[model samples]
Target: MSMGVGIGRREITGMVVGAVVLALLPMVVQDSYYRHLLIMVFIYGIVASSWDLSLGYAGIFNFGHMALFGIGLYTYGLATTLLGISPWIALLAGGVLAALAAALISLPILRLKGIYVVLVTFAFGQLVVQLIISQSDYTGGNQGLVRIPSFHIPGHNLMRDHKLGFYYIALILLCCSTVFLRLMVRSRLGLAIRALRDNEEYATSRGISISRQRLITMAGSAVFTGLAGAFYGAYFRNASTDVFGASLTTLLLSMVLLGGISTIYGSLLAALLLTIFSEMIAGLGAWRPIVIGVLIILVMLAYPGGLYGAIAAAARALRRLGRRQASP
Candidate 1:
């Protein structure tokens, strides 16, 4: 929209440089602690960016992201365990299952407005989690599944490989997901989804097919979130039902919110900043959440548009300064 927000050459260059630094981080920081943090940032960034697709662009404001994610992990866990399928194949299964579930629920659920939509989706999320816990036979219940298989890239078992390889896998996923999302939002479906968010009534009057578009975007959102969950499970070789709690959901949501909803770059920036901060504070042992929460609240208050929003604005300001200085 405005130059204040659109990514430009300088901004792109900065992002590329930042990504390069991250890719090389594992070489510099050999400690698993910091390497794990970087991996978390990359995985969580993908999740937050996916959440922004619906919450930010589609104005769906879904609080049920964790449900989609849970379904994904369970789907992968079950597939690999039961069918003897590879983790990579199971990962695809997870995404498809999540998409199907979202498509099934979107129409009736998305009909409501305001808090009702939030409430319904939230309830759905809670229900899914409980269902998983209850069906211990299929899902491993609340105790969760263990020894999950690692996702393989051809012959490469990412689980057993170099930390740098894992980082590259995650970074590739993030970059590809980001580009895919941008294209999806800019395509015909993207236009419909944005319209549905901005003005449902007018969009409907114009033959936008709100229900159809919502179903598609919801499925799309679930795919990304599900893939992230699959990656998370593979990285850790475990998936606990309880771990997919409201706090984790809130964490992803917070990243999207603090990053600037509807902006993937915002999601990336927020995830990196927030995750790194949280990990650092967590070294404080018992008082981590307090510190993390305070930092989040302070950032929220200080920059309402989230991390990337501020970065984008500052970049634009710098461009203007440069142009003025160059002019006679």
Candidate 2:
């Protein structure tokens, strides 16, 4: 109990210090380009962390998570640009819509096991992408939506002034997502999800409702992913079918696996690092994807538990070494 309390206090302290540093980053960095990259990092981090909630924690193996995100992008984009709705309200609406979609999708596939669930979800995502492409008149089709409005304070354009406002907004979203997911992983629901993941039959025998747990997790994951999508549309001022593509799904999965499955903050950190790395290699042109693929393969082979797991292992080793030295 004391050890757990000590660890909890350390985590709290780390989070507080990290939050303070992030809050002051804009003031210290002063580079609009870097700020933009950091904003992308935060956006992807939110999406990745939310994805981890279902995939890692609950073992849902959802491959269409990006589709939920795409739904939010289109929902918010269309609501604001076509229907003249407030962006803030549209953001909330997008999340609700995505959550509803997730619940609906999970309903039929609740009984599916393993790869079947993955395939169905992947097909669902493809279906969404195709629908977006087919409905060019409304969705902007292949050309994509353009001239979407940015977040603003009436007279002040947030995007016009160095993107600082968007940065802060993304920061707040990331922080909220991190805290929410952290709490979720420690909650009773999370415990039940883990139980189901580890032994579905045992969990079900113990009176844990499999469908109920999955539906809840699916909906919860979609909510944050949708919000991230809404933010993406606002930040980039565009919506494209690419948001629902397999590439992004793969990238996000890589982030989660590379960071450490079931570790929310680790996934967030991986998103940040990977986003920055991708930016750095952008000049490599066509070779970028190959390089990233190789790097991911190497990391997976070397550190199966991912960067976070490797770091934890190293810390444990160092502590052990220190203990031995003290005994001598």
Candidate 3:
């Protein structure tokens, strides 16, 4: 029940400081292009972090995670355009629908392990793509859905702000998702999943219900992922089958792995870093992907723990140096 697993004074302080800096970032960086990229970071941050809950913490090999996002995107698009619902409600509907899909998928994989889980999840993702395409009457198939409604403030214009409103909204979404994921990972639920991941037989021996925990893990991870997808649809005012493509799955998987596993903050950091870094190397043309791939391999080889591990290692070294200086 305790949701304060690894959080401490330093972590709390870091959260506060990081929030302040990001909140003030728009003022310092006035470029709309960069603002757009930051918004993407926020979106991917939510996604990669939520993924950490299942893939990293719970040890679930859910290759269909992006499907949840796609479901949200299409859900929001259809809800607003077809069902005549408010964009805001449709946004939440995306999450709910994706979570339901996750639960449904979990039922079959309850007893499966390893690559079997991966195969089922990956197939599920492809199945979703096929379904969307087959339902072209509503989904727009390969053409995608266009003219999706955007969010509205009471008296303000969201469109005229040069993406300022969207940026803040994305940031808020990332913040909420991070808080929710952190709480989930720090709660008893988190402990149970970690146990399951480490040793399923041992965990079940300890009276933990594998089916229940896995079910919750899958559903919990899908919530924010679907929300991000919904926001993606709303922000761009479009929904496409491309959302379920392998390219995006690879990108998000990179963020999760490069950020470090089992640490919620790691995925968020990786999302921020990778997005900015990819943009920075955009001028590399075809070499961009090659360069990025090489960089990921090198970093993983050097520090298997990823950026979080590197940061933690550096922090420990600095503390050791400080202690040495203070010692007689």
Per-model TM values vs. the true structure? 0.84, 0.92, 0.91
Q: lDDT, candidate 1, residue 92?
A: 79
Candidates ranked by TM-score: 2, 3, 1
Instruction: Highest lDDT: give the candidate number.
Output: 3
lDDT values, one for every candidate = 0.79, 0.88, 0.90
Q: How would you encode candidate 2's per-residue C-alpha lDDT over 1-328 as one tens digit per residue?
A: 1121122667778888998999999998888999999999998999999999999999998988999999999989999999989999888888898999899889877989889999999888998889989999988899999988656677777857798888888899888888778777777788889999999999999999999999999999999889889989998899998787645666788899888989898898899899999899899986877888888888889999888888989999999999999997
**How many backbone clashes are present in model 1?**
0
Better candidate number, 1 or 2, judged by TM-score: 2
- Leading candidate by TM-score: 2
Ranking of all predicted structures according to lDDT, beginning with the best and ending with the worst:
3, 2, 1
**Model 3 local distance difference test score:** 0.90
Model 3, poorest ten-residue lDDT window? 1-10
Expressed as tens digits, the lDDT of each residue in 1-328 for candidate 1 is: 2222244577568768876886777778887667778889988888888889888999986888888888887888878876778888888788888888888769767568888889888888888888888988877887788888876667675546556667776777777777677667767788777887888889899988877778888898888778777777777777887546745665777799888888777888889888887776666875765666666788788878777667778999999999999996
Candidate 3 or 1, higher lDDT: 3
Q: List the residue pairs that clash in candidate 2.
A: none
Higher-TM-score candidate of 1 and 3:
3
